[model samples]
Target: MAQTTAKYHCLVTGFGPFYRYTEEENPAWLAVKPLTNSIIEDEQNNVRPIHVSTLQLPVSYQAVMDVVPLLHSHPPVFHPSIAEQAARNGVARPQKGYDFILHVGVAGRGALRVERVAHKFGYNMKDIYGRQAPVVETAPLPVEPEEPGDVPEEVLHISAPQIEQNQLELAEGPEPTPEPIRPKRGFGPGYENFQEEVYSDVNVVSLIRNMKQQNFEDVYLSMDAGHYLPDFIYYCSLAEVIRSVKPYERRRGTQVLVVHVPPVGQPLTSEQVTTALKLIITWVCSELQSIDDTLAKERFQ
Candidate 1:
């Protein structure tokens, strides 16, 4: 069997509006500096450099074009466009060629609570758009598979007809050769389960899709005014992309890229940055070690 070989290079794009975060000295393009500039190391002193890049695009459809070329899976024959250049260097004309593209930005979910924050109470529960959201359904209790003596009920799959119709209507595009840059997952030694907090936030993109009829650029610019996404949502999106590459190895892949986003126009505290950096390191190291472990099990067999 031939092993896959393609260099993994990540292009991390952050937002640079008219201004930067308050704690920063320079006109910073990114909100979270920890995510952009970093070095990954091991006990043996082997190091892999992580490269970061930022973009300054007006929150518009043009921003979406900046990353689309990078997503080509194959020959990577870039259809050169001026927008690509503007995306990469804020002015350079974008030319064909790039391995992978990643972008992170902030959203204005807090604005939803701002008006309420001024009131006597903490804040109202409506989203940024002022619509009161209903109580979200929690995860249902997992029902274990039937025991050996138990009779299994007939399987019932609730499929969507519209989805099926869409599938039929969907057309295949040019296939790009898959170059996987799977990122590692899980926490590293020490700082495990650090300051975990659960909060409810809507995927504003979904709302935009409903309102604008699936215009991501409109939604992105409107919600992500400063262009930073919530960290967890960015992580989830990153994981989804990786899993799409090799669904079987979803739990056991290295090179997991987590795009750490921050609130608009602010730098995270040192402690917060430290925790994020530590978790990323742990994931990379664990994934590297587990390659042999997964190989021994021969699940790929």
Candidate 2:
């Protein structure tokens, strides 16, 4: 008898509009909306289709808390109030738990950043409602910041031209542009000062490599998922994954990743961003299939 392959499911999330960017649409949602219910075919002929389930999360910190727990649960439940149509359509819960949970948000400026690590701590910056996260908290695991030098030249160059163009526009403005904000070396006061980082469970390096191989542009690995809503969601989701498992037992949990996109009116269009997203999703499903096949062989051996 021929063997049947397992279907892979992904939960892609994007943030809704916030008060700060009232006039402009959040690019995350704009990019993600096109992908919901989309079926991506594997480059290899034999693999089954990869199903994408997308969600538009509210900008509230409270919503992050409420929604993430549901995702972490076994056979995740979708409350009717969240989005009745989406819930009924299987967007809320996958028949088999999600293989990947990708959170997308706007990074204000920069190229398409495939974030490497999400810190447990949040900064003094407020959310959409002017609410702030606690200054410090115990990280689920320790993490070190990646050196800027380690970033690939190809990735760095992705946003160079656009950034330069923006600088020129700001230079010609009525008021002088302020100096660009540089990354801080150490954690600010109140925390132990150690780098408390949790990396994305997804194979970001391989993911980016695949994108480059396929001729995709402007995609880079980012070390910082700044202390804002994106970082909060990434950290919280990762924490839930870890918490779901037994303390000291090794198990393959859901693969979690946060992708930061540039703000609207940037050089890249919605189509370009959406294409990049589809490519990443395809790559992730392919990687997960390979892993599953390897594990199956090991079990039978």
Candidate 3:
């Protein structure tokens, strides 16, 4: 029997200490630290082909905007422009590009929340520096031409599927030799007439059900991701996934998820939070593997 290669790549991020929370450690980063470069094993004792890269993001609105574009272009690895800074800090880049993005933050509440939806707009909140965020801000999404004539000639020459293919290729970068025909998940930019909200395109309901089956206590789904950075990051990350990958490939491309954990010494212990993080990561990898296997089977058929 031959050893199998890793099949999936994931990026996990936690916020650095900020504001009033500065006195205590951020539970999100602490929980995620042990998972970096760790391989999860399924029940059969076979290693799940998943590689995780972790990053600690600054607690600033500007930081979110600056980092997201870099993530979109070359995830797990900083863009060339920031390579020096990333290296100086000993940041680890993924062996390859990432297939999933998970943002973890402390909710200061007791339960572990697997967020169901991320609102498109954010409330007026102040960052660490006392800088104020706009009353409402929309994450950038792909825009279609209003008129047929407005379409770019380069884009017009390609068929609908081909256009999607091209977008997928550009998003994944030149290296790693892109996987052919993965299922992409699309997140609609919510309602135009009403307040916009982007739901988690990943199968959260199934994930929650699976968690319950595992007998993990206090794990529940919540519609609100939060009004602050967790919500902002989720919205931006999802928007980037939409802008970067095609609709068909987005489902299989990169799954964006945000997990809100209670602060330490509240109702949950640090160990419990770590357990929840591991559970979420493992489930994500399993789902991606299923998707990959399905696509591979379809190709042969």
Candidate 4:
């Protein structure tokens, strides 16, 4: 029988405008924003319900550094209605930390990519602010501030660039202005104790296969998440998960998966991307629920 009463929660984040995406809302946010505060259920597959919450993040290293830790250590509260629904279903309120965190970013045209790895060292590309992550001897897992006063404002909220609401077009903005030069930071020559690369816990190969079976033609598994904002955020999220899991665990890596979607109307509309997200989320949730069921059964036997 399906665990119809079980509910899974996920935190989905999308990047704000940057590069050619500055004029309009980012395609990532356009697709992710609609799914915010929504619940997904697959009755046919008997998949548990999934509650999703979303927040828009700026394309800056500082912003990501400030935010990812809070997400892992102290997740934001979901809608009251979601809680009421869970209560009505007779499921416990979700505990600390989300079941998964899906970070979506804009990438090449016409293809949807499920990124498998995040690198600790190659963050060479500057953010929209013309600044890059500083070089470090080792990759440090972000720690939530022990004192509330120590938390930075950026950690609490990031304001997106002002633009007309719901506007998603390729229209050119005012003449391009040269970005001011900012000091560059490095991530050291080599990754030492903090392993050079971290992979996602999710079976991305299986994910792509399932999506293809469902007619999501353009989805592919990607090894390279690039050396940009997407990569930066992915590393932070993966690292956070690494820090939480015990060393003895048979399965490691992270529940964090980064998906790269093409710009709006580049052979795929935001609506299309949104549908893909629902399918992907459903598959991921079902896999996780199965794992939980196995663990629960083994505990009693």
Model 3 over residues 1-301: C-alpha lDDT tens digits?
3435765666788888876576238888777777766666665535456666677787766677668657766535475544664565445555435777889988867788889888765445677767654433245688865898877898678788998998898888866665684222212233243336767778888888888888887788889876788888887787766666665652455788999888887788888888877778888777777777678778879
Between 3 and 4, whose TM-score is larger? 4
Q: Compose the digit string of candidate 1's lDDT tens values, residues 91-184.
A: 2122322223334444322211100000111112332333322222234579998775575343234358866775666645455578984332
Model 4: per-residue Cα lDDT over 148-217, one tens digit each: 6777877556444424331333254455578985443433443244567888889999999999999989
The candidate that achieves the highest lDDT relative to the unseen native structure: 4
Provide the overall lDDT of each model, using Cα atoms, as 2-decimal numbers.
0.33, 0.75, 0.71, 0.76
Clashes per prediction?
22, 1, 7, 3
Between which residue pairs do clashes occur in model 2? 143-197
lDDT of 2 by residue, 1-301 (tens): 3545556788888888776555237899889888888777874645567788888887766677767768767787764446674764457366556888889988866579998888865455767777666434333566678798988887677777888998899888889668985333223343353246877778899899988898887889988888778887887788777667676643467888999999765767878888999888888877777777787778789
Question: Which ranges of candidate 1 are over 4 A from the true structure?
Answer: 1-10, 18-28, 31-38, 44-58, 65-69, 72-103, 107-285, 296-301
TM-score of each: 0.34, 0.75, 0.72, 0.74
* Ten residues in sequence with the least summed lDDT for candidate 1: 112-121
Considering summed lDDT, which 10 consecutive residues are worst modelled in model 3? 182-191
- Residue 2's lDDT within candidate 1 is 32
Q: Give candidate 1's root-mean-square deviation (CA, Å).
A: 20.3
